[model samples]
Target chain A: MVVDIAPMIVLGMVILTSLAFDFTNGFHDTANAMATSIATGALKPKAAVSLSAILNLVGAFLSVEVALTVTNSVIKIQDSTGAPNPALTADGGSALLLIVLSGLIGAILWNLLTWLLGLPSSSSHALFGGLIGATIAGLGFSAVKWVGTGAKLDGVVGKVILPALLSPVIASLVAMTGTWLIYRITKTVAEKFRNDGFRWGQIGSASLISLAHGMNDAQKTMGIITLALIASGQWHDLTAVPLWVKGACAMAIAMGTYIGGWRIIRTLGKGLVEIDSPQGLAADSASAATIIVSSHLGFALSTTHVATGSIIGTGLGRKGASVRWGVALRMLVAWLITLPSAALVAALTWGIGHLVGGLAGAFVVFAILLVAAGYMLWHSRKNPVGHHNVTDEWEASPEGLAPELPKEVVR
Target chain B: MSQILLALQAAGQVLLAAVILGAGLPAMFSLGMRALAYGNGGSAEVEVEAQPHVLGKVLAYICFGVVIIAVMLGISWIVGTGMGYKLSFEHFLPVFRKK
Candidate 1:
């Protein structure tokens, strides 16, 4: 049965798909901001998520430069003449929509699968990976604007990877210096006071880290939506992000943050390393610094990676702190695979769009996605993860209960 | 006039449709979850403890802020350089000078 679809209807599908991506993005990356505090008993799981949600909203207003970059720089738009312009027809619009939706599905599925297995993966990588994969599949290799790809890659390597690799080292140095200074200056101060002082410091540091995360991570979706709009020729130039776009993206991400990515939180907060108050403070401080700086400069670095590095560095900084190499290794594997995988999914979806043709094809694809997503949600209800169980303990096991810590670590 | 109106109509249709679907569904879902959580009388208290030292906490906050700003600058510099702009600390800040 063939059904005629309107341009407006197609546009609606794309927007919904984008929001779905945003929603998944929120829960997927929540652990980046709240993991350490949850692990160290600094904040209750629910309270931590609530705080992150509010800060994410506030942070979204701070910048739109990154969104502009995403729309204009990352995705190259072409005109009807097939020249490089940002005017898109109904066909191009639907293709872009399908690619984005497929990318989100791939990312959401990967996140859930990883979370179920108690692995802390990079949500930022997952989203990028999905886009890359879908774009490659739909547009083929040539459809990828090599210049934009190259520029983005350079940023990823120099700004994202280098800083991530260095953050822990830098953090350790700063932390060691800070710790040493505290000891030297306050030798006469009581041990209890020293610990108390640092704890208060951690609270402020942790809040900043959460705020920074919102500033950097949420902009990514804004960029994606803008790219879609520009590619379809809805916008003439890469100018300001519309107020509605900003509000919607911010709201979607904030809501996701409120829901929390419990699975990742479990792995990060408890599985990787035991966090004390001082270590939590140090890690959060480092993460906040890296994320905020990256956001200001408009580098779309993964907050997950920076936060993970900080936590690892903090662990190493503390004497005899056990680092779980096995889990860390697993997370690294996911990071390596995210981009290529999502790109492939997008490409395949694009091919399907070609076969179906125009509005009919778009509807067919959208219906399939809805049915599949609905089925997944139904299946997930058998073992759902919700607010009652959105904590480290609940996420530690598949059964929504905390399992016993390993024998050596329990000591 | 007809052609221009047609183009504007197309753009408006697309934009309006996306807002309803993309932003609307998630907002509704989130609101639903929040209502459920509140109905259950969930505690609003954050469980995390504050670090005790005012000075240490202040320093950490300052350091954290500096790092975020630096990273943002670094990203912009890298992207800008790739796009053929000269790399400098000034480029990292908002005060960009015309060449």
Candidate 2:
């Protein structure tokens, strides 16, 4: 009885933590799809998030492919067919459960910290980073799939690092060309007429991005939860995610989208460039195309990186518009550190959990995550960036990198 | 080194596809809008005394039709992939195949 209850408690923590990561993934990425639309007044602040939320829910249901092998790219916990390694499944899978829990804590903490800082870091990278860190702590470094075997692009370098380096540059070039072409094509059209036409274009392209986000991002969480279930010997199927897991993930992400990450939206929208409707359309179309094409080609890329690159590219394409290099540089720095920072945190969490041992260790890790998350939430309240002030005029700060913090609202 | 080479090949493919669909589609949309402005004339264009042209309207509709078709293809691609089908082109005609 004691043995059974310990695994159950650990399994419960894994499910909850995976859901929490999914929620963050949703809000963290809302800006990727809707920031340009909101920035250009193509959609109202509240309406943009609401539409994205609905589209995300629909997109979540659209994914029929089993992403159960998601962990194969970064770590060696699962075999090629998405089955948990039998060695790790010992002691009712308590070992696998602890690594997953600590990794999730690392991811969540990094995500919340970035959110509070108004930085648009990749949630996927954070997740990979956390997992990699915890895996190093739990298993030896040899267990990590650093590079793919043969000619295949399979491991961390191929899937994560290479894509991170290249996707943005590709997206930027595509967007720059699109922006320049649109401006050249519509040079004779009246500005007001051009803006009106592209507003509809922006909304359409943005919706495509939201749908893609739901289809792709939701699968990652579903994969994690299903892996947890399989490890604990509760689920047997290695191909299909449980329906309840799918539904719960869909709801969590949609709810996060509706809540909106206004701070990141403001930064991507106003901080990167003074986006007009035509540029918004160009940027979003570029993002939508890059994401779709990459995923189709099986060269997975982060939506956030593509979107940011597109926005900056638009700034470069426009004749007089200038990109805030300072802001762009800061974002670049954030991206560089996201993987390592999350890894460090996760490694630390795993160390602490390993020290305490068993169910108590899992609880200790969970408590630390709760405390860190609560503190970040409290810190964010100090300079809240909500729908009310999300699109306030961009003021360059002397300190640099930090967008001007929203002015305190007196009730 | 093989991984780097493979990643580059994939990146090149993505960039090519992205330019055609992402950049090219928006340019087509802009062209449609430009043609519409020519068709409407008057306040739609920078020229104050321009006349609406019937040919411009026809051209505008043609451009918009192509864009609508592309968007439809995109939607179908999303739906088909969700259902575990891959969108492929055989002799320039889009076909769905079981993946």
Candidate 3:
């Protein structure tokens, strides 16, 4: 019972799945950049999302260097035989499509669940985790190009994790210095002028952070889609991305941005720290600088991690700022689990696909996904979360609606 | 000429299926948000305090669904046709098998 599908049909499926992942990526990560501004009242929620969406579209057109990293730098496209394998190329088999679609399902489910619980997890990590898990299940451990994975790890550690760990420390020091100088220089200036100026500065800085987010995060989906093509053997190499691929990924993410990830917004904006104008400005500037530099260096860092670190730094910099350790701890736990969890789901889906063959397998996987999604939607209706209650009030604990104070109080 | 025609029909089928699947999930999410924003049953005091711009949010969701499906279908049509194939939804499942 062999199934004979045309190469073009397979190619089309790959493109569609990539767009689906891209759309999910947009909605999932929107909270990373705009949550703080929206939370602090620095930017209206609608305006913040609109700005992020536009910048994300612009950023998608700027480069494909990161796309190369995902297509060739992460997974071993060639089999152990090392022959001219079409499956390893950009237009060969439908397996790549299956892998990508399953991975997306895993990541999207994780994102929706976390959002429902009002947790701020790293969407970037979730996607990566899903891909790795699915890839492992589809192909064995040998299929993982360790060298490529190592290179990505080096970039993640040096460019992403290290900076994430240190950015807050640096930001805190910089903010402390900036605040002291601001106070010293503006001793004679009216309080109104000083506060107002910083408030405007925060807006500009926040916008920059959103732009940097567009440049780094959106490119990831582009890479994954391109990788699917390359793995399928449709395209020969990491050539120019088709205009449709670029446009679809950009628009999908932008639309997701417009929809907004309101749950994470509260966790980031008001849950982590009470952000004032000056602190918000300082943090936004630092995050923007870090993300842009890394993007230029071709490292894909999690914008969520960088933004969270910056906001924490800003909180620490201020004398009386309240940093909520309990919420922060919860967010960190989600981060730790996202990659492995998504991978496990991907592995299970791949196993199921293997049990069935060709179109039947694909249909079975799709049907199961629909059922799971339906169940999730039904469960969500039991306790709905939307824009009106998408704030800290929804996360209100027994103590009160406000986030609990940090264990080590700053003031 | 026959080969080109077949390719065009195949591409159209693929494009249509892609659009429906790609846009369906987001539409569901958007509708979910709208229902939560406008649904009755909460205490009057809570409802009064929690009024969101329901019409605006629903409109945004509709526009989002339309735009995404349009873009996906449009791109598939242009790319498929430009590459010498016609885009359609029927190609979502392989109809022609090599004998």
Give the poorly placed runs of model 2, Cα more than 4 Å off.
A1-3, A396-411, B88-95
* Residue A324 accuracy (lDDT) in model 1: 77
Tell me the spans in candidate 1 whose CA falls farther than 4 Å from its real position: A1-5, A71-75, A78-92, A145-195, A231-237, A297-299, A371-411, B1-99
For candidate 1, the clash count comes to 49
Cα lDDT for residue A19, model 2?
95
Residue-by-residue lDDT tens digits, candidate 1, A1-411 = 854445557666777777777777777777888888877767887888898888777766554455455423233343323233422445556556666666665666556555554455667666655655666666665555433222332323333334334433444444333333333333333434434545554555566666666666667777667666665656545555667877898898889888887767777776667776666666666666555444444444567776677677666656677777766776666566555555555556666765887777677767766776676557556655554554445335735433222344223
Candidate 3, chain A: TM-score? 0.83
Q: Report per-candidate DockQ.
A: 0.02, 0.89, 0.01
**Candidate 3 residue-wise lDDT, A1-411, digit = tens:** 954464446456556656666666677677767776776667777888888888677666554444445523334554332222365344356676777767776776766666655566677767766677777888777665433222233322333334335434443444444433334433433444345545555665566555555556666777666666666655555545656667778788788777777666767777788776556655665555445444434444566776776777667656777788877777777777776777787778767866885666666666666687677668656555445654544245423333333333212
The better candidate by lDDT, 1 or 2, is: 2
DockQ of 1: 0.02
Q: Rank the models by DockQ, top first.
A: 2, 1, 3
Q: Can you write out model 2's per-residue Cα lDDT over A279-352, one digit (the tens) per residue? A: 99999999999999999999988999999999999999999999999789778988998888898899999999
Q: Which of 1 and 3 is ahead in DockQ?
A: 1
Per-residue lDDT for B92 in model 2? Answer: 88
**lDDT against true structure, model 1:** 0.57
Choose 1 or 2, whichever is better by TM-score.
2
| Count: clashes, candidate 3 | 23
Task: Please give the TM-score of chain B in predicted model 2.
Answer: 0.88
